[model samples]
Target: MVTGKMFDMTTPAALLADDTAYAEAVETAVKAAAAYYATGESALDDEAYDRLARAITAYEAEHPERVLPGSPSGKVAGGAAQGDVPHTVAMLSLDNVFSPEEFTTWAASVERRIGRPVAGWSVEPKLDGLAVAARYVDGRLARLITRGDGRAGEDVSHAIGTIVGLPEKLGEPATLEVRGEVLMTTDQFERANTVRTAHGGAPFVNPRNGAAGSLRAKDRPYTVEMTFFCYGALPLPDTAAELADALGESTHSEVLDRVAGLGVHTAADTAVPPRTASGAAEVLERVAEIAGLRAELPFGIDGVVIKADSAADQRDAGSGTRAPRWAIAFKLPAVEKVTTLVSVEWNVGRTGIIAPRAVLEPVRIDGSTVTYATLHNPADITGRDLRIGDHVMVYKAGDVIPRVEAPVAHLRTGAEQPIVFPEVCPQCGSEIDTSEQRWRCVRGRDCRVVASISYAVGRDQLDIEGLGTTRVVQLVDAGLAGDVADLFTLTREQLLSLDRMGETSTDNLLAAIDAAKRQPLARVLAALGVRGTGRSMSRRIARHFATMDRLRAADAAAIEQVEGIGTGKAPVIVEELAELAPLIDKLTVAGVNMTEPGATPPPAEGEEPAPSDAGGPLAGQTVVVTGAMTGSLEKLSRNQVNELVERAGGKSSSSVSKRTALVVAGEKAGSKRAKAEELGIPLMTPAEFAALVADFLDEE
Candidate 1:
């Protein structure tokens, strides 16, 4: 077990004075580093480890004559890892600065050491993964070596064929060593875990751990893919003298470009590529820019690296025993934290999917106190080897929900208990369907009547003002309602008999329920909570068929003609609507509206077809709206804008794809807007979209 007492004892004099405490602190740090470097699993998170190491460094600086041999100060991998294979050039670590003030101080020091202003700065994301040296001989990938220590590394050539971006052959015939990081992208990590578990292996806790373990493994039944991104390149001792001279003379930016040209991946291939910053200010700006885009990046980054771009400047600044004097890492806040798994909760969703949720020990991560995280499914819990009372890594990025990455098995004390999954539905005590990865109640939405009914009364659905989840549960428990259709049959006397139901509240609720009968067929379909349809999809379906009777008559083939409804989903929708026939009949008898306004119904058999509105600007177009609207659209909600699109004879979509006809990009448009541009889809500003849809705006 690793102790974090040193994190609290930050004072150098206080730690140096206590001999026993100081020694314990050193031992704790050494063990943490060893675990982190060897398997990418540590008892402490990155921020905690950094703080403890900084304290040790401060104490050592004051008592240089009494420094311990196991001290982590001025050491690569904290002097905990070593190997026999010597690196062509020392794979030195970068000294870190946590803030802009510290970065500015480091930059000033580098300028003073060089005796002149630096030529330029190269700023790039500091990838969070295992550092390695990839050697090439005669343009062929020859070996892969991990950065065991600064001077030497362990050979991991077994991973050569499995790594993407690091090609088997270079674009040109050359003998050199390229230094880069080997990591699993977000998508790769999930796939690796799935493949690993299928092969009867324990799932890796995180991407970094997966990469480290996969890189060194041999003779495994499964191969997990990883990605490589070169940050620097150097000439080997056997390299041509002319090439060595050119490599030594080239600037960092130029060398990276050449690396990318040689079929080796670099930061140049990413969205936030290395930029040449004129000074410290620009470098800091680049750092912030990269940090802002961290959540959106495919791979993980712990910090941003800033280095002197000019080779001459790097030579003048010189190197330290563990790091370079000319480069510094601007560290970002840690997005992952190690916390205890207190317990697991099984929740029945509206559709009866029994999801497992991890209850954590309230650890602070990425500026929030995360007490709960998503566990995905029961299979995930088993594959990850997670247990109650075990230490687990909790990861949160930007607006995404927190998730339990994996259990830190090394930190288990044997007291941890296995997480038990339910054989029956947790909410209704019914048999669960476990054929799929996600367990579900055999009764589907009926198993959770309260939640399903509450959704039906939501603002965008039936618009019943007084009915919420609590009221729905009360009504269900009192036997006054069993489903959305039963809600319309609730009588005044039955509602008045409830404990909290006053005369005023009951009358208001009754009026709301009566008003709901006139809602459009689209809203009524949305209230049904079909498995494969949502609000927008319901609008598309209702508009296509025009009436409930026609919609009930549609087969999978007819449903497939609706916008965004594919072959697979069309069948599912048709099946669900068929099962909901009894509920639809009840609602129809209760006088709920079954027709959509402004929708053109399909022609009857042997009937003449209506003329097409070919002159309409968006007659055959599929349009998507993204980001915050402005101008005339400022007062309109997203659903209202979608309504306007349909009124103008366009099919509105929530995602951008190759089939997308146009995109209305508003202010602060993010990935969807970017995807539209990438696909070469037509784009319009919000003002331009507003002008085009002016004739249909009032139709809402």
Candidate 2:
């Protein structure tokens, strides 16, 4: 057992100073852990909870008679008592071992209990997701229940049908209760958050939290995609070996195969090579291999579960009051750490949403020095009770963006000040709108012109070459361009007046603006910066309506016919299109293309159709272009390079992965060049890229 400072005790030496105080602290810790485990979101991290649990265990060991009845040490971690339905069998939490030595010690204890050396062990990644028990009766999914309090769980049968990787009907008729994790992939999490942000809701902190919250969302429709991975089964097998036998399989690995055959998803790739080892060193090596691959895994994994592979050994080893004695979860070191909250910075996004970011006293976590973390919104900041100068717990959610979990209240001083959300926009002094969870500038287009224009000139939109953020800001500040359409009307003299606008630079800018007028209708629609309309949506809408006139004439019902344009978003699209009519008219008057090129009506009978650029020189290749280029490509922006790649019938990727067949590296080329060299991918200079495009055009 471990000893630490008591909850109310100021010093470690004073932990056992008062018996009553220690007892109260233990009780409080137990309650907090229970609540957190039940809800899947916690004020304290796993490490903190472990410390508190260890403290209570140490107290109980010294004074066994005074052990609290509801202590976390004596029972499985608590879960939601109420759910959609009750679990058929109790879903108990596993005992966690932090170190390989601790794991070895546990394995020895299991061997001692069984009165024999263990044959082998089965190891698998411990996914960080919501625990759910899915029951199948007569080859059909009957019910789904959340792991609530190791006893009764919530019924989520309604969401069972929507769950990916979970078959509604099994391959064969059988009454089996499959226990697994319900989780959202990284891409799914991002998409869900994007949609949620557009719909005026706060994005979930992490995928695990997102999955748990989305699964239990009562008010909203169940549109969020979630995946399930089966890890266990009922009739309550004593061990993985017994589970295999129960399923009429040979090895623990085979049990997973059988589960997959039943149309239930399992992490078989990671769970392979069930090795038999007489010594702890061999088992430790296997565990280490699994831990090393955690970063590359699609889903989040906090640890690895090592289970005794023999059914007899597990049976003889028996079970603890809470967890199985034959199995132990070797928890990975936490990616979170305590850091001082220096201050909070609010940033205005393209949509006018004011997002709060936490500036932290630099701390290293998961191989990266994290100096900043997202506070999400004002409500999240206040709810977490975060304040400047407070020591706070920070972690990288999904191993990507850093997030402030909560403030360390015990480490706080009176100097800590509350973060006040601003009443007005920092950029334009516009009144802030707090109607939604995320506060936004009320003066939408008038004040947020910089963001709108920047997005409009983005790679996926108009593919404007020289209209970068700095130029856009200068243009907006000088009142030369109020909207995206205004860019086309600027004269060479107006551009030359801006700072650093030389003769060649002015000419290049003019040429780029002139070229943007010929962009396809889909790109033009995307460039318009319509609410909830992205590249794909714009393409779909343009394809359906064919021309800008038809799209402008489209009502909500007609817009709703387009795929992904639901009832909620259709009206917004129609309203935004109507609002953008003036801008459209301005662009039309300036000779911007209203119809998609090459989409003209077919030629008359006896007349051959014009040749298409579908089979261009660079066709069927994946190219990744990086760094600033020289020569003809010098004036071409990153978006322009990508546009060139697309026009040549090749896909332009942002990263140089194994799928990248060619990499166009320019001056001051960085990591991408190094990676390409290492991978032996074909490399090209800016001049070479220009030549390649010229060749493609010559072929056309």
Candidate 3:
């Protein structure tokens, strides 16, 4: 229902008279985006280019005959997610402009065609955040994908359910992927650093990086401090304002006002009049002014986004290699300065991959001091031809870890030499190995590190109150304890004999060790010197067997049979479990609690069991766990039941299914329970359905 005076692109036939020509235009746009991304120069700013891309897609959607080869509309990039979700589109990146001068040139070009200067413009601050595609189905969020390598990104829909600022369902029933940026709140970024400081881990460098990295960690736990907003909708919305109105869930800047109503954030600053008006110069002026004020914004801003407010004009402008002619992002200049590369050092990771690091003359950048930065790997040294004494340029990607962006090679003298990776592990003196992706230490199995007592005392584990990494290392080197088990063997006399262990501290340390003995098998599994088996996976492995004895006895096939375990991992798991059997038995005799009891079975059938204060809610409710239960991922069956009880307000019964309240949970689910849970709720346990139920129940 939207149109413009000068351009007519409402219908597919109107946009391109020839079907072949339309297909070529689509191909041209996809290729242009790929080529521009390949080169340093971008074809269009992200928003503009995306609009054009959407228009091309709209054309194709209207006329199947216009569908072309390599049409972005035909194929969607698959998102790689640890959970069950999949992405319908591969979100692509926009070529960015870095200065106000670039913005002026772009606006002028538009004006030359429009035959008039732009009218009054509106301006909004540019926000620095992660680019993503959030897909919705039936008005509910379906999937979220990152812009990976331009083809496919890792799927992160599960994280979406937990991400606080996004809505699980929109105002209307619509199936589309709303693309935008996800960001860390200002307060979160500041508080994150404080917590990071409390631990030995370095604080997150910036909000954007924190948001991006959190979505991809796949294993590390993340928080709900992230937020998202949509500026544009795709496949093209029924109308632009309608979509913008959906974004109005957040704000009311005319353009953003509509977008906010659509439940998206509007970063529209200075909405200049149509591309045909005289206000064009004003648009350029305001964008330039923002370049100066951007750094002062409460959150992060990478660039200003300028887009055509009219949906029809956007279709007319269409798309080129990587962007649309209707919109452009003017990026702020890089915060670059000179600093000395004090020294080069090589560090070995747990994997035994040796990489070079640059120690620098401490300098501040974007607000923080720059003392050191990662060089990525030794190949970077030889490729960049870096020298230790030469000055280097360091860059932080949206405030994340600062990396040696590139060397100021011109400052280097003839003294530069190629850096080398260490041939062996420094700690264990084992040979090094290499992968297609990374260099690895060939020390213990999976290059396993001897569990540093530091981990043993971590909050989730032993939690020895006062012990820290520095002290743990000291204790280990002094031979006070050899492994997690040896901690208990220490007495007051033994501890006081060490560097700083006082009489009172010794008692506390002993208490912690005693407490760790009672930790469950899953924690012990995580604590043991195993490769790739973290706490989450450990719980998963524990659920496969009734007791530590059973697990230690399991073969790879038995282990792999457990959901989530794949063939590639079978051997590694089998070998480790067998190797650790002796140690597990020793600890068992040492009075360590191994496996925790499985979920209390649902109350027996027809038995008048006492009404306990805290009986299992899901008890006696027949349930089936399926693809990616957000809860209890490790305990496949118990997890499914947990979902039924905790998420769906249903229960679990061991023997009854047809009579059960719900048999909910996803793929790989047997037909027996599906038929039962399917009765009224038809409880299909797909991770998605469970999530949908969860969203609804949460409202109560």
Candidate 4:
């Protein structure tokens, strides 16, 4: 930990920057943080972090290129990370409140300012993601900006190019401004975790971290590389219900709808401020009740924000020079528990990676049990220096994955044993390679575990139906099958013998497995669990070599020749094929259809289709036009292009997907157009896409 001498509140300390001023700075920061998190405020989110962060920044600015070792600015909000944006709106953090007394005190503070109990306010969920702004002019999206330092930010304007849901334009008329949060979906986070593990990057603590990291990643090519969502808008409408009612059911929803619409994501139910803090507290309780549901929501939120509804009253109320006076946020406490790490267990994965999981004495957190949090892999144990019998502090970090925050080394017994990792694959007995994040068994195709089984039964693999997770677990637990070869060898009678296995279900499963045998060699290769090969990669290999034996006969040189299969991946391919070859021959001899039928098919006789299966100007084109798009020429208006193209049987692509055709250039198209060019995709002026979609443009 970076530590510095405690600053003296008033005078000089040679060891410190300025002892007296530094102490005052520290006090101010702590006070600001205390104000932020104690209650979740609709006024501003992440208040505690914001308050201290601002204090640190002020001191840093005074002494350029200098930061206090222990200053809050040096760390992320939760004291977990240390990466900073160059100079976004100094991201002033919010203060929090937990108890009704604290909430009441904050409310009284607001009341004191307003000189009366303020009436009519809006309370919104404090979505735990990067906050951004959408500026629309003449009913069209002009620019999408991030809340960098609350004032200035890097022109991530390119996000408009790829982030879904945020439209290139607004749904209503006249210039409109909207502010919302960008968040990640659970599926996306899980996928990122898998990828990050593979990439040797730090695991993102939560969706908020995921969003913040991705959005600020200068190297990231697209915003969707981190999923984004827009919730809550400014420019309050006449009535609370009217504005809330219009969000989903109006043109405004449509204009900014592309971000969420493309993904089919839903927003949290918004509500106006309850008549009283008790009522507001009750709504917050519901938010807390589903805290475990952080995984289910398409977006992430930390707590509920309650705001006074009356815009006029809100103006009359004013703010604290730091946060809005009309709003207070009620946040659920972080799910932290003091649990004994009774023991540690090492489990091997499909690839023979040994992952250590902690077996904790049971406790409740976020409404779930307190046992068995993943240690990630053998390496994590050493990095964290965790051992069995440590009285550890475990918290459901970010309300998703449970992790050991820290160990109470003070409680460690002198007799604790250091954890050890296995040197061989438990399933196949292959030698393991101890690495930083994983213990890999180099046996390649031979090891049998979760990743392998999932790959084998994947949609592009054996295509087995009725052989879902339950059946797989049953088969594995029964000890009758140790490998994929055993799966094809199972008889209906053997399957029927398992508990809960009905005759009809057994018959259907057998049929499904039988049907899967006829699938092509690419799928066979995919099912064999090649480390770096996926369905898409497998397809590239198949396109290069049709039959399994044919591909197997080829060496590493030939495998590397495939479009997607790089030389680095070739050895894994060859190793996998070598291990699975005998099994394939056995299955083939077992009457499984191992190859595609018939003689080599004739080549296509016509010109190849456009890169996109459908070819029109817009077919292989992407356009993001901001500002007023005037006149018809197959030209999509900023207001209507999103729906028009999609409705016209064309898909509007996000900033980063392979499906993006061309990003249409427009005035201040922001980050989307630049990102399109960076991605090496074509860029087109409105006229270019216009001439293509003549039918729609000619309507006028």
- lDDT on C-alpha atoms for all candidate structures: 0.87, 0.73, 0.54, 0.55
Q: In order, what is each prediction's RMSD in angstroms?
A: 5.4, 9.8, 19.8, 17.6
- Model 4, 246-339: lDDT tens digits are 4434432342343343232225222211222234444344333333233333555556566665555566776543456666666554455556
lDDT: which is higher, 2 or 4? 2
Model 3 TM-score, all chains together? 0.42
Error of 1 at 408 (Å): 1.5
Candidate 1 structure lDDT: 0.87
Clashes of 3: 63
Task: Mark the regions of model 3 whose C-alpha exceeds 4 Å error after superposition.
Answer: 1-38, 41-304, 311-344, 349-416, 428-451, 470-474, 499-502, 544-546, 555-585, 599-700
Per-model clash counts, in order, read: 0, 7, 63, 62
- Candidate 1 lDDT by residue in tens digits, 137-165: 98999988998898999989888899999
The Cα RMSD in angstroms, rounded to one decimal, for candidate 4 relative to the true structure is 17.6
- Number of the candidate with higher TM-score, 1 or 3: 1
Better of 1 and 2 by TM-score: 1
Worst 10 residues of 1 by lDDT: 1-10
Candidate 4: worst-modelled 10 consecutive residues by lDDT: 1-10
* Cα-based lDDT at residue 109, candidate 1: 95
TM of each candidate vs. truth: 0.84, 0.57, 0.42, 0.43
How would you encode candidate 3's per-residue C-alpha lDDT over 117-144 as one tens digit per residue?
Answer: 4433334445667667777776778678
Local lDDT at 558 for model 4 = 73
